[model samples]
Target chain A: SAVISQKPSRDICQRGTSLTIQCQVDSQVTMMFWYRQQPGQSLTLIATANQGSEATYESGFVIDKFPISRPNLTFSTLTVSNMSPEDSSIYLCSVGQGTEKLFFGSGTQLSVL
Target chain B: AQTVTQSQPEMSVQEAETVTLSCTYDTSESDYYLFWYKQPPSRQMILVIRQEAYKQQNATENRFSVNFQKAAKSFSLKISDSQLGDAAMYFCAYRRVNSGYALNFGKGTSLLVTP
Candidate 1:
């Protein structure tokens, strides 16, 4: 089991601003992912943050909008840039060890006005 | 690509009664895992139960259990002796074995437990 701490539990931002959410894991993990959960919708994978390499993003999501940084095995950050009201959602960080189950952070709830 | 579907958007159950939440998934991979996660009003996601595709026996945890029909690609959760605390939004997710472990989640089923 892994313990994850996500900062800025809730934040209100204006349009065109950027907000970076950080996730810190208790253990070193090889696979880390970022996800977005919109109101009344399911979770959608945003990207896979690879250590020391460019993050692999899912279709419909771009690096310019949701840039990710994986400095090491235990930490990663997701930045939502040029925010819009549509971008108001809960962002989650997840970690997995090999074939084990994925664990998620509490999530950062963002509200763009 | 894999997809999970929870057909029921909302369900109601009386306390101490039994209720089942249906989940179906589409996947080409033979080896994978299915999970049921519960998210209360607090917004913390908790793992309720899990079932491996290769396992024939259903997985049970206390009052929570799963009915896994691999051939039908259906996985349903059954909560017996349901308590008031069981009220929450439940999500069904899938992960392919040997994959990066990124989960494809269902839209979720909101359970309401009435006393």
Candidate 2:
């Protein structure tokens, strides 16, 4: 089991501003994942952060909008640049191996005006 | 690509009664895993149960159990003697084995427990 601590449990931001969300894991892990949950919707993978390597993003997501930084095995950060109302969602960080088991942080809820 | 589906949007159960949440998935691969997660009003996601595709026996944890029908591609969660704490949003998720991929989750079903 892994313990993840995420900051800014909830935040309200204005349009065009950027917010950086941080995730810290209790144990060292090779990969960390970021996800987004829109209002009344399920979770969608935003990107996968690998230590010392560039983050891998899923289709329909771009790095310029959601830049990720993985400095070490236990820590990572995701920045939502140029926020918009559509960007309002719950951003979560998780660490784990494949399908076995995944542990999640408390999640950062962002509401953009 | 894999997809998970949960048909019920909401369910109501009397306290101490039994209720089942339905889930189905589409996947060509034979080896995989399925899980049921619970999210309370606090929005804390909790793992309720999991079933391996290869296992024939159903997985049970105290009052929570799973009915996994591999052939039908259906995995359902059954909660016996439901409590007030059981009221929450239930999500069904699927993961492929050995792929090291992220989970595919359903839209989720909201459960309401009545007194």
**Interface root mean square deviation per prediction:** 1.0, 1.4
C-alpha TM-score for every candidate: 0.96, 0.96
Tell me how much of the true interface, by contacts, candidate 2 captures. 0.21
True contacts kept of 1: 0.61
DockQ of model 1, rounded to 2 decimals? 0.73
| TM-score of candidate 1 against the unseen true structure | 0.96
TM-score of chain B of 2: 0.97
* lDDT of model 2 at position B48: 87
- In angstroms, give how far residue B30 of model 2 lies from its true place: 0.4
DockQ of each: 0.73, 0.57
